[model samples]
Target: MMRLVASDIDGTILGHDGRISARTVRAFQACADAGVEVVFVTGRPPRWLYPLREQLGHSGTVICSNGAVLWDLAEDRLLSARAIGLEAVLEARRLIKQLCPDALFAAETVAGFHLEPGFIENPTSELLAEFTPAPLHETLTAEDAVVKFLAVTHSGTPDAFLAQVQPVVAHLVETTHSAPRTALLEMSAPGVNKAVTLAAYAASLGIEAADVVAFGDMPNDIEMLRWAGHGYAMASGHPEALTAAGYQAPHFDDDGVAQVIEARLAEEKLGA
Candidate 1:
């Protein structure tokens, strides 16, 4: 029987309008009542998780920064982080710059969001206020841990950007992009994708891959989807994710995750 539900947030459970549907909420509640764990695995940084915490109305463990950090929602603290070193960060930046001169850079540290002045294109007044503007090197201190490294360009789609940069930085760091349209890439320490961290967490709980169900809608979710025994790619997911997952569910907006969970719960009840 499945004992855990691991899901990506942005395009899997949270709608584009920034709302979690009532049906999704009910399905999660049912999981909680049935003693199954629900973990949100996403490329979002910890600071971006507050709104989701409010919407969910409960706290638990969240795998954040595409599994670079493990967060405790109840305490609003980081349990652990597999951060990128300063040398790696700087080296990756240097290598990418050689290829794309105009590539903008940003870093999500344990402290907060730090960015190059133009990292975010057309920033709103609020965003401009939230991000600390500085050179990437100046933003981090020797003691600071870099959770995720972000880079973006105005030249091509995200896929194209990844194709160009991945080969260059493959030796330095792990790279992936969640946004299909934007020319942005998110990087973490080598071998620190969603699946690696999720597997560790599940092992700690004595749950095997065969007892876990996962969901996602992007390239970043590929590893996790492939690792889970029953991985569901959203019908409207990216082509890579659809190919990685063993099964497909309805689109996120159509309550695909809830539909799958509810069906499994019914099956469990019937079998019991």
Candidate 2:
């Protein structure tokens, strides 16, 4: 039986418009009541999470920035966060400039995210409205440390950019596509990802990934799902993520997260 449940936000937990359904919210509350950990693991920053953290109740810690940052939402503190090194940020800036010359690029920092001109002009429908955009150097600089680079490019460039950036900066990143046409490449300490972050979090509590059941619907969530003992891919998940999971949950629009969580909770009760 699963004791922990980690889910992606954009296309897994959140409805397409970015809000969790009333049904999902109720399910989460029950998960908390049952002492099951419902960790929200995503590629977003803390500020983005600020609005939703209060609703999570007794859910587990947030695994943010593709796992570069582990935020203890209840405690209002950062339990762990691995920042991208300065030089790598610079190199990444240059790489984005070269590959997606017209792409929108920015760096994510503890303070907030900074954007380059025209970088966010074409965000995914869901993201276009939520994020605040600002000039990169104006908001963040070499002096202001960043956790990762969030790049927005036409669908055509993601594969090309990865091919080019991986060989040189592969050691610095774990790139995952969020929007069908965009990539959110996070740079952290070598070998960091949602999986590694959750592993560390679990170890801190004497828990194991095998006791976890993760659900997701995007590329970044693949590793998190694979790391869990019982991995569930949302029925509407991207192809790669779908292929990585052990089971399928309903799509986000249909309350997939809750359905999966409910089933697992029942399984746990039977086992107990």
Q: Local distance difference test, per candidate?
A: 0.91, 0.72
What lDDT does model 1 reach? 0.91
* Per-residue accuracy of model 2 over 200-266 as CA lDDT, tens digit each: 7777777788888788887777888888888889898887888998878887778888887777778
State in Å the error of residue 134, model 2: 7.2
Off by over 4 Å in 2: 54-60, 122-143, 155-168, 183-189
Clashes of each: 0, 1
Give the number of the best model, judged by lDDT.
Answer: 1
Q: Where does candidate 1 stray beyond 4 Å? A: none
**Residue 17 shift from truth in candidate 2, angstroms:** 2.1
> On residues 7-122, what C-alpha lDDT tens digit does candidate 1 reach at each position?
89988988768888889989998999999998999999888886567888769999999999999989999899998988999999999999999999988888788789888777
**Residue 212 in candidate 1, Cα distance off native in Å:** 0.3
